[model samples]
Target: MSSFLKVLFRNVLNGPSTDPFPLGETFTPDRLRGKVLIDPELCMGCGTCKEVCTAGAIDLSELADGSGFRITVWQNSCCLCASCRHYCPTGAASLIPDWHAAHPEEDKYVRIEQQTVKYEPCSNCGTLMRPIPAKLARKLYASSPELDPEQLRHLCPACRRLRDALKGRPFPVAAAKVPAEAQA
Candidate 1:
């Protein structure tokens, strides 16, 4: 009886070992993974984040009309691994560890981040396939010496292949003329 009372007194004096969360301010530790942020201006909608996301937190979809693309990241589904940030080619995805979100038992916790970008069609086939981010386009143009920005850069893979194949072919008349000229 004496020991029980002493223990109770000690607990009262020392207070609770656990933090008073929800009722009191939640303490966020260092390197807290809070939320994922995607900069619409910087993001190219390349689907790199979507490919790298192991938790399936990031989603990329094209608009039904084929005019643009929509990129979405679900906060609740995210594991806070930051793989999307690392794999992002444009450096658009980032983690903002500012504040810890308050989660309630009854309600669904969700913070959906969405961004949209317009699609650039293929030059020859007019296929709306590539999402040419301005920064990526500029970088490619600057680095590739053989890439002609004005004429060749915009062609799709199929069109470029066809053009190359045609360039390599010799006309039947030219081959025949070569033999006749040699005989003469």
Candidate 2:
């Protein structure tokens, strides 16, 4: 009985052990890994976040803005490993406190979403894509400088592949045959 009374007194004097956050700001430890924030303007959409996320929490989806893409962070799958934050090249991803992240539904987790910038249309199909026109052209023609940049316009992967298929121009399969006399 004495021990029980002591416990009761301690509980009353110490107050509730639960943290009051959101409504009342709560303290966060220095090492605590919190929610993530992504800045669309700074993000290059290089897929570095998706690549480094071990939990597969990051999803980059196609948006209406030409080359612009949408980033979806699945808080449910996120382990708060900070891998995505560290790998982000543009300093677009960062950790922030989400004290009120709790939800009644167990499946629902906190999410940070944004969309990247839209670039000009592709020359071939006139489809808007990534803002870097020169880079996109280089990706399409790495070795061949003969391919015209005006012809390489901004095209999504699907459209680019379709165009390539319709061209029906077979890519070089092997080196040109050397003359038999040259072999000697």
Candidate 3:
């Protein structure tokens, strides 16, 4: 009893071993994993994030109207491994340091992070296509001043390929298929 009293007195004088988290600032370290986020504008609907997710927490689906794609991240299923963020081609997947993921068991299924990325019609061919974001387009075509990135942004894949292959050449039989507006 005397020894116990001595230990108790020492501990009391030393102060609380654990922080009062609810009433005070919690210890959040740098590089802490918290909420998974997807930037709709930056994301190109590539399945790289879903493919790299270690926990199988990410899902990609086409919208019902076929206008866009949807990405879903199950917060509860994510193991906070951050593989998605690391492997994302566009740097669209990220984690914010707002670790408020805890919730009652009943809410587990509803805890999800979702975003939609829409498609635009190709200006040349009138086909639906994902537009190359201006930033990425500029990076890809920066060295080629002859190729206008903004103009090519409106072309479908086939038209863009044709334009690139026939940049300095005359209009061949195949090139005749491109309309006057698309040719210019």
Candidate 4:
């Protein structure tokens, strides 16, 4: 009987404990995983965000130029895993506190946009590579065209190297015998 009275008094004193969420501002701590914001300018079209995202929320599409890429964020699929944010080399992906990303329709959950960039071919090989793929490189070439080779050349440095490496190799070779220890 005493415990019941104490409980009743406590409840009366405390008043309503239910939060009026959505109507009132809720206190959120710092670094709270909320909405993910991708800075297209800083993205390198490397698909690193898509690769690291555990929830498979990010998708990258090749641009029409074949030299650039676009990013699409599926807000519905995002689990706030923060893998994309941690592995982003350019610091392009960030967590913002805007949790009101919910939409009335399912189609409104997807956000897609193409990153703006001035694509330039490699100076030594003519292969197209984002000049400022890295944050430091972006800072350096933020405003100016730093390299040469305006025309799209078939041979790039990496491709040329690969071609040379495969030049002397046989077209096809018989499979080598597997060692006893290596057998599955």
The residue pairs found clashing in candidate 2 are 67-129, 122-153, 122-154, 123-153
lDDT of 4 by residue, 1-184 (tens): 9999999999999997877787885777787887787886677667888988888888887778686666877777789888888998788888887676656675574453335544566544344656554545545445745422232133343543443466634322221111112232
lDDT, each prediction: 0.72, 0.65, 0.83, 0.63
lDDT of 1 at 126: 60
Q: Write the per-residue lDDT of candidate 2 for residues 67-162, one digit (tens) a residue.
A: 567788877678889898898866778877664566667536534454555555544444445533454456657777866554554444444565
Which is better, 3 or 4, measured by TM-score?
3
> Is candidate 3 or 4 superior in lDDT?
3
Deviation of model 2 at 37, angstroms: 0.9
lDDT of 4: 0.63
Off by over 4 Å in 1: 1-32, 103-110, 122-125, 145-184
Model 1: per-residue lDDT, tens digit, 1-184?
9999999999999998888776787677667778899887678776888988989988898889989788989887889899988898888998887666666855454467888877667665565545445666667678766655555546555555655666745333434233234334
TM-score of each: 0.56, 0.50, 0.78, 0.58
Model 2 scores worst on lDDT over the 10 consecutive residues at 173-182
In lDDT terms, which candidate is top? 3
Return whichever of 1 and 4 wins on lDDT.
1
- lDDT ranking, best first: 3, 1, 2, 4
Taking all chains together, the TM-score of candidate 4 against the true structure is 0.58
